[model samples]
Target: MEHKILGVIGGMGPKATSVFFDKVVEKTEAHKDQDHIDMVILNHATIPDRTSVILEKNEKMFITAIKKDIELLEAAKVDHIAIPCNTSHYFYEDLQKMTDIDIIHMVDETVKKIVETYGANCKVGIMATSGTISSGIYDKSATKFNIDLSVPNQTLQDQIMKIIYNDIKNDLTADTNEIEAIIHDFIFKQNCSCVILACTEFSCIKLSEEIQSYCIDAMDVLVERSIELSGKQLKSLQQNKSNAAII
Candidate 1:
């Protein structure tokens, strides 16, 4: 089978890009080597802070960075493309207009899956970047399917952003257990069916074996959906290639 390469416009911070790739590999149902989708990881760290740009309403630097990445991915002739950064998706329309490669909407697919697996009105606690919150990306996703959306209070929101920017983004694993416990509290106390990891960095702190058991990782679904839509076969993922090859 011909290998289909999926392009990643990443490096809003390298950690999240790495996590996204790991999940993409893990989510692949490949049983053989050739069945996995090849990837082009363009770690364009030159893109400025999306949260600040969005909040500050300064997109020139961010837009330029995205266009550079889009142009790079298109020139690489990748079969499809996905942006790992959640906040950067705010410029999806702008980049999509410039690129010929299909741009997969990662959050939209996660929301659709949530609605299908849970229910239309499922209560979900969102953990995301400030930009993502301000942009109402998750809110938009929830509203599309009539799902209930809740975010951390202003204080907690600021704390979450710090954890993401300071701890995860900087590659320093700050103890987010206390913060995550509060999130866990919301899941049970507030009667949320699950929590949504709206920020890519939040995925890192979610490494707790306990938290992993509770929160649903929207990133996994996004990657799996990208693979499916990218026309990648199910056999060539770096791991389990032999087992999934038959598929």
Candidate 2:
């Protein structure tokens, strides 16, 4: 059987990309290696932190790094590609013009699913990087999909920033008490139906089964997409089976 290959442009946070791949495998309904999608992961950790450079006004370096990886994936001739970072999507138009390959939009895809599964006008909390918030990626996507977005107050946004950058990325969760409390306030007290873990770094969290009851982690949503788009489904190949030996 011919295998369909997927090219993943990852390593925006380095580890988030790795975890996303693991999720593709875990979510695949396939029962064997042959049933999985073939993929090439360009774990280009050298790429600068996308959110930092965007929020900090440093651009050329990240643009160059991303272009190099996109070129590599194009050379590999993979069927589809996706970057798991939401904030980095501000650069999607630039990348799209640069490559012929399909670039799946995490922001767009996640919003479509959220509305279809959640509702058309439900209130949602966003827990993305400052850059993601600043760029208005989620807000735009949500508006396009007709979901109302409510953001935490500035003080709470700061607390979220610390938990994502300082706590998760820096391995300083023990000292993130202030941020954890803020998360609780945004979800429980605010009556947010769902909170989008808009930053990929938040994927490293161990969501309290309590939080899991309401919020959907962003990375997990991307992985589910990777699996669905992988072209590995037996149902996808059913038409080709008509040529099989007569039974």
Candidate 3:
């Protein structure tokens, strides 16, 4: 079988990109280094802040940076690509026009997973950067899936922003208690069945067990789709168990 080369357009915040790549490795069905999928990772840490570009209406630099990354990936001959950052997906359509290579839609895949796991019309909470929430990228997919979407109030949203930018991005320790409280409010007060960690930065933090059961990481969805589209199978349930034993 011809294995497809997967391209990762990453380093929106840097750490999140590393986490996403780690997840892909952990989830792939590989016994040897050669069994792993071929990957090209462009850790373009120079890409400007996506949230700022949207809010300030200064998108030229952002678009140019992303387009350059895509061009580099295309030159590398990657079969498909995935971007870990959700906020950057605001320009997803435009990016697609710049390249023929398939860029997997992280938001769409997360929304589809929510509907598949929770059912249509289920209430879902979004925790992301201000730009992602404002752009309504996930909202569009939610509408398509008939899923009701809710977001943190402005005050809480600010807290989330701080966690992503100040904490995770800066390599500081994330406050798990704060994240847990936010999830609790979404579930109990807002009546959401599940919360989507719509920001790639969230992948850097470890969620509490209780919250883990009710939360979905958008980055994980992207990783799974990246593997599938690249013609690789995710590690089977039984294989995962056996691998754990070998550790």
Ranking by lDDT: 3, 1, 2
Give candidate 2's whole-model lDDT: 0.76
Tens-digit lDDT track of model 1 for 1-247: 3557789988867877887887677666666776677889988877799999999989887888678777788888998888887787788788788877888887788788888878898898888888998998888878988999888789888888778877777765868676577578778888888887777776655466567655766677667777787666443445544543545
> Least lDDT summed over 10 consecutive residues: which range in candidate 3?
236-245
- For residue 211, model 2's alpha carbon misses the true position, in angstroms, by 0.7
Give the alpha carbon lDDT tens digit for every residue of 86-133 in model 2. 888988888888888888888888888789888899888888888889
Model 3's TM-score against the true structure: 0.95
Candidate of highest TM-score = 3
Which residue pairs does candidate 3 place in steric collision? none
Q: Considering only N, C-alpha and C atoms within 3 Å, which residue pairs clash in candidate 2?
A: none
CA RMSD of all predictions: 4.0, 7.1, 1.7
Q: TM-score of model 1 relative to the true fold? A: 0.88
